[model samples]
Target: MKKKMMVGGLLPALVLSTCGLAGAQPVAMDTLTAMEQNPDAGSQMRASTEPVTQESLQEMRRQLEEQLQQAQELQNRLNAQLGSLEKRMKKVEKKSWEPPVEIHGYGRLRWDKHRYEDRNDPNDYKTIWLNLFTKYRINDRWALHSEHEFENNLTTNHGAYEGQGGYNEPGGKKYSRPVLQLYAEGRVGEVNVKAGRYYLQSPYKFTFDDKIDGWQISYGIPTKWGRKANFTLSAGNTYSKIFYGDKENESNYWNEGGDGNLKVVSLIGEIPVAKNTNLAMHYGKIKRRNDRLERKTWSIGFDTKINRDLKFWAGIAKSDSQTLNKSHFLQLQYKEARPDIPGSYDIYIKKYLQRGHSGMTNWFNDDIAEFTHGDYKEENIANNGNDKVFQYSRWGEFNGLRIGVDFVPTRNTKLLINYTFGKMGKCLDKDPGRRYDYSFFRTQWEMYF
Candidate 1:
């Protein structure tokens, strides 16, 4: 019976392959008759009553086992071939395997033209500067970054300082030139160690005037809650030309030990609240040893999405310039549309208030200039024949406001317009050169890739 069953199942394949199926009429009739008697019966019936032989039973078992083994082998081969084809398809399309390394940078050929509306001195000049940046990535785990900046105010013809006295250049003249970024970083485990001259994002403000030449170590990590956190500690001297000491001749850089050394530590954290909303906070302390000047500041900020087309942010900051003094700053921002939209607009407003002296000395005095590496050494820190430490209204006016707008027409192009107003304690008003209300406007464009 078993042999008959085995032979019956194989008959269909044999008939279909070699018998031209149409000529197998007798076999089809036999198959139908056997199926009617036993639904699973074979097309070729053997003598079932012959007392089934052991050899025949063994043969049927062997054939079924062979067919099963063959079917499994064919299945494995097909799976392997399908896998190879999929791999080739992935190779043909980008973004399939590991992500590729990418590097990008941005720069601004800035030109600031001002007309001294309140004339202690009436003058109009255009100052130009160029900033360049570049970066490289070796793989997912390592990267190299650099930025070079050069500035030459062709109208004033001084890069380091707009004034007459500066470090002599090779051409028997003084001029500012390009400066190197001079920093390298490597990642190990979860920490990134960096060494060399680099830019510090201080809590005081975000501008070139506050950037210092220094070496720093920084690390960042994301918490289980998905918040981003960062920490940094750095030590460096103030720039040259700033004054320090009880007398003019004793003046020098802060780290040279005339007054003392300069140091700074900072931390920042950011958390996401919604798809387009976030919260941010920052804290930092700056120490000046030689002149006994110290500063600590902190800020808290939040960004919220009002709708698909609008976003807003607000922040408040407080600062302690020394042990007994305090200052405050507040800012607000609103975006009409994102950079994805042509002619999209952004607006920002800021206010600043200081109750006590903002550094050791208020005005840009010769000593303060030399002490802090004053790039604007001749800006005059003294209160014009007065010992008021700070000009009465300039540093003491306890109040200032700023408003700005950004218009982006494309992904790589932008326009910025801003205005500022404050009371200079001792700066003069136009009529008699007496310090009074102050206001100014600035406009610029930037391109990047």
Candidate 2:
């Protein structure tokens, strides 16, 4: 008998196939002879089996080892590709952050007129006021913010006593440039810090309270309900030094311990009420170096909305001159939900009141006199060229009433019309049983950029 072996294919699997076997159909004698011959490598004679060969076993083992090595090489290639992809993803994430510089601003042009019995040189002027804000972010927790304002009476441009009866020499069309806010803001742990020149917050908002030039510290915590509980404290200048007479002082800022400056400090806090509503409480005291309230004031109020259309706002402030102060505001407004939608429209009506003895507080962003409290109106309203008696106000001292309308015809423009009527509770010193009523109308076109 003879033994036959197969070495037709180099691959392990195909080397064991029997599809090309030599005997397909044989005669009886031939079949007997084939059965008698040793079967091909994948088969054996029925009566006996061929012994395994050491050399054939070694070849099979070698092929298996080669296949293992190829699989490992393929796996290494896949891992290398995966590592490169991960590195690229990390780099892209680092580049995708908020912009480092920002700019925004708002401007308004107003045609304001005040008329009363026997008024000379009608108090009418179309004034343009613009404010621009910019910010540069240094990092995740630090930034520099700067804001400036410009005002043009469209007739003359100079720094004059801007209050009542103020004067600007009629000359060229120029604007007054004033820096409103410039500050470096950052955070250390949970505490927020601000330094440089910025408006000192007085309760809700006070313009004449004077800008502070010092440092501030603040903090806030956010709740799951989307409201933040916040507190702020600030220190800066109020009224500065005194340089009176032969006392060798060049200014009249009392309690300036040789620094020729005065210090004012303020503390304010806010508490969340509900969705889109909150209460703010604030206290501010201007101290002489001797530690007395040179100009002290406080404010606490609630500003909220109902059904997203109607709003109720009320607040009060008290100072040495503004005692028993009070204020109230209510408005019904309808505006487009967002800027992109085409059907954008806004119309609103508002009512405001401030009355009582020294009943006054300052509302910044408001140029209307009836809404102003204390001396801010007394000084500025007269400059509108109105009768001194006509300046009677419900401002922090007298009783006042205001009605205003705001309408938006376009996405970026708004028109505002407001009227204020006021009367003092007591008689004017110059006149007996004074019954002078004060009122004015202002029309404004406002835009944002």
- Winning candidate number (lDDT): 2
Sum up the clashes in candidate 2: 22
Each candidate structure's TM-score, on Cα atoms with residue i matched to residue i, is 0.59, 0.61
Q: Candidate 1 — which residues are off by over 4 angstroms?
A: 1-119, 122-125, 160-198, 202-263, 273-277, 287-295, 306-312, 318-320, 323-325, 336-340, 354-398, 409-411, 425-435
Tell me the deviation in Å of residue 352 in model 1: 2.6
Candidate 2: which stretches are off by over 4 Å? Answer: 1-97, 116-121, 159-177, 206-210, 238-262, 288-293, 320-365, 370-398, 424-435
Candidate 1 lDDT score at position 388: 35
List model 1 lDDT by residue over 211-292, tens digit each: 4456566676665546555666655654321122211223342222223245555565566655666777676665556554
Distance from true position, residue 436, model 2, in Å? 3.0
